[model samples]
Target: MSLFLALVLLLPSSLCHRTKAQWHTCDSGFSISATAMARNITHCRKLQTLGAELGINNYSTTPNSSTSIDVVFSALPPTPQGWIAWGVNPGRHPQMVGTRALIAFNQPSGMPVVNTYNVTADTRRGCKLEPSTIEVGVANKAANYSDETGRLTMAARLTLPPEYNVSKLNHVWQVGPRVVGTVPLAHAKTLHNFDSKETMDLESGVGHSQRHHDIGLREAHGILSVIGWGTLLPIGVIVSRYFRGSPIDTKNKWFYAHVGIQILAFSLGVAAWGIGLSLMERSGQYRAFMGHRIVGILIFCLATLQVMALWLKPKMLDKYRKYWNIYHHFVGYSLIVLIIVNIFKGYAILKPAPRWKWAYIGILIGLSCVALGLEISIWFVFLKPDDKKAQTNASDPSKTSNPN
Candidate 1:
């Protein structure tokens, strides 16, 4: 590879967490603390430091930064979005692909997620309007949407066409069944100051711009995180070897370290996959996409192979050397790529939430570099050297002789 290319390969493409100003965090004190931005960061740091050393507690940046947060293009915009009056959504938008934002909660210090999204407009769900006694309720069929709390948290807004009022406003709101959590676009809607109205004088259909759903967002996040972690960590280490002088050879400590870490990383990845599955079953209403299901099966199979390889490694050392190498190579590399693709997929499916898509770019690119490095090093150490040594041995058998 060219020097410039090699240099670029080594650099962290994005998501370096290098920018202190990436997020616009402020105190709302809604009696909710995602990270308790309450304690002075200095105190957090001190406690965080001790926690880090002992590997006990975790340090968060907010409701103070304990978790990594992301949103879609709109959600991550400079302005603020509207309120959900419900739980949080993980998906950016159903039609979109890619993470618009991302947030990592849970500090190394064992801090709990401080994010307190409004569970209901009534928090505990005590408020509700009596059925159809209201004229508009019967006319628009809005009564069917009320939950135990009487608030229809599952709703999406349709904006007025630019021509009619030309306001670019979502004055018309569409309410649905009892939505357990908040949709990602709620952030966008709030930031845009989306206003709701019972109906417009000229009623119409659900436009893509105007239509909304109680998107199962929280579950989407778990799906994205698992794929994201799997992608960047594995591929980044493997792909980094494209660099001109990286110490990526198997004989080199870097290679073994990379492999060991990846193996452990994949193992941890299982936990992430489980979290995603749980979130799906909980919030996604058990609706799963083909991609997610297939990816899951692949991960399971790959893991099984990894475990078997570890156990039968010595026994099959000679007979199945080629098969073993092939299994590891294909599964490892494939998993890395699969993870990146899956993350992007989650973003597309989770509409409304925007931050995740953007943050994912940085993460995907940066981690790819790391994975590439590790992957290249393996080839540089084994594939290239092995071929050359075989040729040398054939050319001069004398060099292959061992008197001992």
Candidate 2:
């Protein structure tokens, strides 16, 4: 169950989990330094034009530039009581104000594409924001900048972010607005041009590392199944013969090793599985890669059933008894075949036969299948037949027995 839980957490986290540091959050209303604000202007410059392409607004600011930029914050009309604000929200999480900043983008369709920030601020520019300070408002939020054009206004929104401080000479701006990142129909061409031509080489390099990790990890996962369900069980049974009824009840060394190895293999496979899943998400191959998850669930069920069967009735000697052997063989062999078949399914999804993936899977499958066929044929034709004839002759020698 612990292993299962670990696996469950790995999937979604691997797929969609974002780095919190990149999007640090506090209670409510945050601030960012003026220097960090300058970087957005440079990044956003290339992402201007019409229609939506792609955009990004990173909060992690760059330092050392002694420049200030213009900043404007929209605020609620001054109340009769004047501007008011509080840090700890009503029974909700408190926000770290004066340390976070707002970052807005122009993404074409809310996809994760590298673009520039449409909204920015800096100290040297001496930018001024409307209702600049964290204060009481209609939304009870701070520093909200939005693109007024689209039905779904924002391409990305960072809330309760960290780093809300802004310092410029005498003006130290402590403002936290709902960081709004937008992909306006206004900046489509520029974004597309940079995303298509300028970004191809850089992004390809990043994409390569992610894709390679996925393909390798996924392919290795199949090997885990072969080792656990296929090879381990038989090895355990063979070992058990030597210690059929020993002090340690060493019925099968192979079985012991099989179980232990399987548990460990599952652990290792889990690591690989997680890496593959994360890579898939980063590469945007999640749709085609969903089948891998289904296969994992099935493998979990098979492993669970086998474990439960043994735990529920740990009959050491009875395991080798005639009736028990029949049940054991049936269940054990079924699991092996199921795992093997699912491995083939994984190969189909991850590989393109005769291609990189196909060759790897082909080698494993071809060998396992041929071995299984030979083993079965040899058992039925030679081993089992001889045993059966010996039994028949022994029975004939006792002809005096009553038919009833």
lDDT of 2 at 89: 22
- Per-residue CA lDDT of model 2 for 212-271, tens digit only, reads 234344444444444444444434433343334434555555456656655654554454
Q: For residues 27-137, what per-residue lDDT tens digits would candidate 1 score against the true structure?
A: 242111122222221111100100110000122222311221111100111212222221122223221111111111222332211112222233113443211121111
Per-prediction count of colliding residue pairs?
A: 100, 48
Model 2 spans with C-alpha error above 4 angstroms = 1-209, 212-251, 280-287, 308-310, 314-331, 352-404
**Which candidate tops lDDT?**
2
Q: What TM-score quantifies how close candidate 2 is to the native fold?
A: 0.36
Quote model 1's TM-score.
0.37
Candidate 2 Cα deviation (angstroms), residue 8: 23
Q: Give candidate 1 misplaced runs (Cα > 4 Å).
A: 1-228, 235-252, 314-317, 352-355, 367-404
